[model samples]
Target: MKISCSISFEQGLGERLMFFKRRIEKKTYDKSSKKPVIKSSICNGEQVAGFKDIATGAFEEIMLIKNQDDLVEFKEIYGISEEIEKIY
Candidate 1:
């Protein structure tokens, strides 16, 4: 499943892409001087919602969890935390 989220800032797309590039272990690319692309597939009902950052560009990715265990494991593996912030 591919989830689309709005990009809510006016900044360099490369900087925005770098933010997520450091966070998620995924492939990112720049196409024809357009916004950077973070490509991933949704399996087991998990999806990347969108991302969030204002200065460098920010958005969020949402995922659907079918099992509580999986959610917990994801949080642990991803090290999700309120204090954790992504920067370009």
Candidate 2:
């Protein structure tokens, strides 16, 4: 008698491929000119994670903050350890 697994070799390969595709690469931002910020909408309460220009007060949106995991991922990608500021 012989037993076999349910998942095929192609399916296993596809899963591995997806893992590689979703892997996040390390990124950097200008520390001297920009700081991490979370922009929250006053009415809808939507939040976005990104960097803000310190002098010019311009915001560069990076990712959507739907949950804590997404916020953590954003911090990890940019290697940010300090507290992020929030704005309206």
Candidate 3:
């Protein structure tokens, strides 16, 4: 499954890759750069609908932040254009 999500970089690059499991796991960050590095991976057979924080550079999963208040805030800040398509 490949899910496409619109991520706001704010001050980072675009089209960066990241990994995904049933939920996101650790061990994906670059020590030298001190930023989250994708290393060209998408685990759990699903494209994650999320984004990285420009300041922290951490990849965030949409499913993890599904709270009503947070979702509304995030949608207002980042918009709700990102979509995840399940693979059959």
Highest lDDT: which candidate? 2
lDDT per residue, candidate 2, 1-88, as tens digits? Answer: 9998653245554642232335678899999999999999999999999989999999999999999979888988999888789999
For model 3, the stretches where C-alpha displacement exceeds 4 angstroms are 1-45, 64-88
Supply candidate 3's per-residue lDDT for 4: 96
Give every collision pair in model 2: none
Off by over 4 Å in 2: 1-22
lDDT score for candidate 3 against the true structure: 0.40
Candidate 2, lDDT over the whole model: 0.88
Per-residue lDDT of model 3, residues 56-76, tens digit only: 656655433333444444444
**Ranking, TM-score, top scorer first:** 2, 3, 1
Among these predictions, the greatest TM-score belongs to 2
lDDT of 1: 0.40
Model 3, C-alpha of 63: deviation from truth (Å): 3.6
Candidate 1 lDDT over 1-80, as tens digits, reads 99998764456764333234233443332323323212245543333323343345544454444555444444544444
In model 1, how large is the Cα lDDT of residue 42?
50
- Whole-model lDDT per candidate: 0.40, 0.88, 0.40
How close is every model to the real structure, measured as TM-score? 0.24, 0.74, 0.24
User: For all candidates, what are the clash counts?
Assistant: 13, 0, 0
